[model samples]
Target chain A: MTETLSIETWRLAASYLFLVLLMIMSQLLKLGHGKEFLMATVRMTLQLVLAGYVLELVFSQQHLLVTLAIMLFMQIFALITIFGRVKGKIGIGLKKVVALALFVGTSIPLAYFMIVVISAEPFYAPRYFIPIAGMTVGNSMTGITLGAERLARVFQTNRARIEEALMLGATPQEAVREFLSDTFSAAIIPTINAMLGMGIIFIPGMMSGQILAGASPLDAIKYQIVIMMGILGSVVFAVYLIIQLGYRTFFNERAQLLGNED
Target chain B: MQNAFSLRNVTYRTILSIPSLDVATGSVFGITGKSGSGKTTLLKLLNNLITSDTGTVNYFGTDVLKIDPVTLRRKVMMVPQAPYIFPGTILENIQLIFNFNRKELPVQVEIESLLELFDMPGMLNKKTANMSGGEKQRLALARVLLLDPETLLLDEPTAALDDENARAVFEYLAWWVGKSGKAVVMISHSEALISEFGGSILALSGGQINSFNEEGSVHD
Candidate 1:
């Protein structure tokens, strides 16, 4: 047989092409809804290609300021994604509160671990800081979005029940007390289940990448454990803050559910 | 025993600009009209679930609009036409509004007392989600009554019950009204219950309370 490219290079190239083909097929088949999928593909390609060029520059310069700026930009972009998904389903004013809560609750602890615990010096080491921040912010964004969307939908659907409770002397929070657990559980379950399936079903991305980068399997596994714990922590903190923020939306001076938008 | 609640020029409209009406205290306050007459909207006004564009709601001769809404809520409660049961034990379902009630009436005591009063003592530990339609109605009644608001605004409390269950539910309510002496404002199409209650009945039509009937042949 004729000699061909090595297996790893061929695998990477084929997979990348297939990913594009899948995006095109999704649009062609009309199986997936919304123009967002096509838009998302375009966004992913453009952003990642731009990110690669920037990272090449970043790696060479390795300036702490550059790393910090990238981390800040990632956090802001994650916040906006969360805001966009949630605001479509709930109050738009809630977006600012959710974004702030997501950043403060998640980023604080994540930055702490990155600097104080991991103790990576120059403090803003792009390789360590950027990926970890991306992972933390990305997962927290999902958790917050799910939490906010579930809460808003529950209130909108069960508003009559809420009003009935108020009529019966329940505070707005107390009225929604039954629903809080439901929302919290809904928000966190996906992460928990993924954690459950992480090892037996499939290796997570970070650990797999670490192994491919020639780290010992055990070292990669330990890193995965630490990252998973960080993710769980970030998800929990973000969801809790959003719930607390979402509850306050229901009341005004008169203790009524602020007028339903639709 | 006393004129329990009052409303003066209590006007409510959707964002779509519907007109408002007023209601007085201690009226049997029959909110009856065609389906889209905003009967529920007007009932929501008394309960303060819906706010009006103009005018004030005065309960106990105090402008309800000015009072703390939480405080006002304790005074004015509603039993929706179709009862909704929270996902909990029957005792918890009944005590839905009492989440902050410090006394926390012993669950057994509250359930036993409410059930015996409403003739449903057997449903104490049952999950509210599984309750039958009649049971849900009784559970809802027990819930609102536990809070003991001065004005009870009921919207079709027995709408879905069988004739026997419906009669039983209304009888329980009528007996409770007599015993509690609170103003019972029920929105029902049941003329038999309306005439039997024998308080002032105001017929609502086209978003206005136009008929005040003292005595009329009552039919279901």
Candidate 2:
């Protein structure tokens, strides 16, 4: 395998020229986002540099406990981001349900991919585990957030039909089944579209990263395929779990459709 | 006869507060009040759609909270003011009850008779999306009638219909209660219709009972 060329610190600092050009272009166009763009660039650089150092420490330590702790931290961060993305006030009970769904949905496939699919040495190796977990959990976080928001919105809008069904002796499950299915479909469509456009429309970031790291194209393609499949599985599972459980929150113990007070 | 619904000191969200009320079987109970006087909220309470913040609501002496909501709703159905029309043909909407309960569909002859009774014979095959407001109201009534609940809590069932159609709906409902001996608690703004059909009336003002009348005789 050919060794990948490394960029020196001075040469790497040259990448800031692109941001300067972007700021200048924003100014020329009167877009008024020049300050925001500069701030974002600074934030991104700082965050990535901090992440690099933290990852280096975690990678060198290579302890199972450290790896699991990082995974837990990522899951918590993902859950918070998801809660932030969802519109309207979601109950703490519902938030717990979503967190649990996200956890189980991400962990199961992650374990399967690491243990059975790739069979990585020291199964909890930070290098393999962190990236795989990140990809799956990150994708599924977006999926569940979209699903929860859509479910809440649709349930509120179509409340009359749902209540009509309930009055006709339909259980809460039977009443909202169609809406739940629609939410799942909406949540997964983006991921499905991304999969469809892979390789032809654009090479995925993971695959490009693998190729840049001096791995053979075929080897990179194999890893990409497995990770993508893992991501798809995790997203579908998370969205399904969230919708199935989340829908019940919209009804009461007496099977009546609860109003969307929030 | 045992009252179909009984409430005592029932309160909800400061918009509804009933000290005591009873609706008996084989009787037409009329509810009258201005908009937002909790007219609809009273009907919702009968079916356990919304529980009271305080006090008790009972269906036939049994606490509504204790009964299985699905079973209670099947027995005591509420037809809202602006009823929802499911996406489908009129026939499908009418037949939705059977589908929901996993029962055999009603016979064609029975459906035809019901359609004829509701003055909707021409709408059996028409899509519900194509129905007018009044037609949707009738369709909603037809759909609920298919379930054959013992007590119907109707909120402005004829609000969208013309006088002729409204009278026709009331006439059918009068016949329905007489024949089946089922109870009805109806909220309406038409004082004439209420006086004509209501066996008893409960007038509300700002969520509190203003007066109780039997056979159109006001008694505070």
Lowest summed lDDT across 10 adjacent residues in model 2 chain B is found at B211-220
lDDT score, residue B185, model 1? 76
Error of 1 at A76 (Å): 3.2
Task: Write candidate 2's Cα lDDT for B1-220 as tens digits.
Answer: 6688889999998788998888878767888998878888888888887788899998888999999988888888778888888888988877777777676777877877877777788667899898899988888887777767788888889999999888888887887887888998889887678678756888889989888787657545
Q: Write the per-residue lDDT of candidate 1 for residues B153-176, one digit (tens) a residue.
A: 888877876777677766766666
**Which residue pairs of candidate 1 clash?**
B81-B155
Docking class of 2: medium
Fnat values, one per model, are 0.72, 0.68
What global local distance difference test value does model 1 have? 0.73
**Which run of 10 residues does model 1 chain A get worst, by summed lDDT?**
A1-10
> How much is the lDDT of residue A62 in candidate 1?
73
